[model samples]
Target: MEESKSGTVRAVDRALDILLCFTDTTDLGLTEIAEKTGLHKSTVFRLLASLEAKGFVTRDSSTEKYKLGFRIWELSVNLSQGDDPATILLPEMERLRDILGETISLYIRDGSERIRIQAVQSKHSIRRVAPIGARLPLYVGASSKVLIAFADMNTQENMINDWKEFIDISAYKDQMAGIRKVGYATSVEEREPGVAAVSAPVFNRSHQLVAALSVSGPLNRLTLENMKDHAGLIIESANRMGNMLR
Candidate 1:
C-alpha cells in the first residue's frame, strides 16, 4: 500500500509540472508540454488525459492544443484577486481605452522580457496595438521602461549593464531615475518609428511591481511631450488597477 501511495504521489507531481509549463503561454501542444517538462511524450499524454478529464485543461480537436480550462479560472478568482494579474485588472484597461481613445495594454516582466497579458485595442482606424501575448524586449518602449524603472536594484543593474545598444547607458539610467521620480514614463519612436506611448507602474499590495499599464497610439495622434500630459491620468488609472489586485 505504501508503494502504491508513492507511485500516486509521483504521478501527481508530474501532472502539476505539466500544468506549470503553461504558465508563460496561453496554450500548448502535447509535444510542447513534453519538451517543456522534459518528460516523455507518452507520459505527457497520460497526464494531460487526467487533467482534461478533471476539467483542469481543455484540448481543441482542430489544433490539438491544450488550454487552461474554466476550473483554473474558478480557482484563481478565489484568491481575493490579490495575486490575479490580468482578468481583474481588465476593466481599468477598458476604462482607459474609453477615455484615451487609444490602445491600453498591461505588461508584466518575465526576466529580461515583458509580456502583454491584456490589451484593449483602439477603435480608430490608425491606432496601434502590440498583440496580446506578445513578448517584447525590456530595452525599448514606454511600458518596457516603466517595468525596468520599478524593478529591484539588482535586476535594474543587470539589465542596464547587459545593454549593448546605441543609446548612452548613463543617460538611460538618468532617464529611469526621472521616471521613478515622476511615477510615469513616455517614449516616442523608441521602439517603432511612428509609435508613441505613456506608461505607469502598477503594484501589488506589497508595493512590488505587478505590471506596466500604458496608453499607446500613433505619433500623429500623440507626441512625447503630449504623452506626458496624460501622465497624471495614466498614473491614477494604474494605481486603481493595482488596488484591484488587492
Candidate 2:
C-alpha cells in the first residue's frame, strides 16, 4: 500500500510538472513538453489527455500544440476570489478606521486602474465615501499611487507616458522614490477636491505587492499634519495584514 501511495504521489508531481511547463512558453508540442518535463513522449501524451479531459489544457487542431485552457483561468479566478485580500484584511481595515476616524479602504491593481475591493465607512457626519468596487485611475489618489509606486519600472513608465498630460513623469518618479523609502504614500486633493488620504502597500506570502490599504477623509480632518501623524499607524496596519497573508 505504501509503494502504491508513493507511485500516486510521483504521478501527481509529474502531472504538475507538465502543467507548469506552460508557464513561460505559450504553447508546446508533445515532444517539447516531454523534453521540458524529462518525461517520455508516451507519458506526456497520457498526461495531456488526462488534463485535456479535465479542461485544464487544450490542443490546437491546426498546430497540434497544447496550451492552457479557459477552465484553468476559471479555476484561478475562483481561487483568487475565494482568498481575496479584502476579505482577509477587513479586521485590520476596521481597526485602522477606528484609529484614524476616517474611511478605510483596500484596493487592488486592475490594469490601468485600482479597484476598491473593500471599505469601512467613517462614522463622522461628513466623511469621504467610496463605494466598494469603485474603479479609480492608477495615476491619482493615495491608494492608486501606492500601487504604482511598487509596480515594475516598465509598468511605471507606461503609466507615466499614458498620464503625462495630467502628471509630470519625472516629478512622479521622484515622489515614488520617497514613498518607497517611507513605505507609504499620501495624496491631498489629488483625485477628489477637499479629500486627503494616506496609503501603504500590502504584500502577499511571496512578497508581491497585492493591494493597498488606505485611510481617507475630508481635507479639514485629514490635514497634511494629520496624515503625517497617521502614516505610521497606517503602515503598521498594512504590515500586520501582510504578515497575516504571508
Candidate with the greatest TM-score versus the true structure: 1
Model 2 residue 63 CA deviation in Å: 53
Q: TM-score of predicted model 1?
A: 0.69
User: Per-residue lDDT for 1-246 in model 1, tens only?
Assistant: 122355666777888998888766888999999999899999999989999999999999999999998889889667665456788888888898999899999999998899998999999999896688788889998999999999998999999888857557999999999999999998889888889999999998789899999899999888776787888989999889877776
Counting clashing residue pairs in each candidate, in order, gives 0, 0
lDDT of 2 by residue, 29-121 (tens): 999999999999998999899999999999998999999988888886667544667778998888888878899999998899888989999
RMSD (Cα, Å) for all candidates, in order, is 5.0, 12.3
Which 10 residues in a row give candidate 2 its minimum summed lDDT? 1-10
Clashes of 2: 0
Candidate 1: residue 185 lDDT (0-100): 90
TM-score of each: 0.69, 0.66
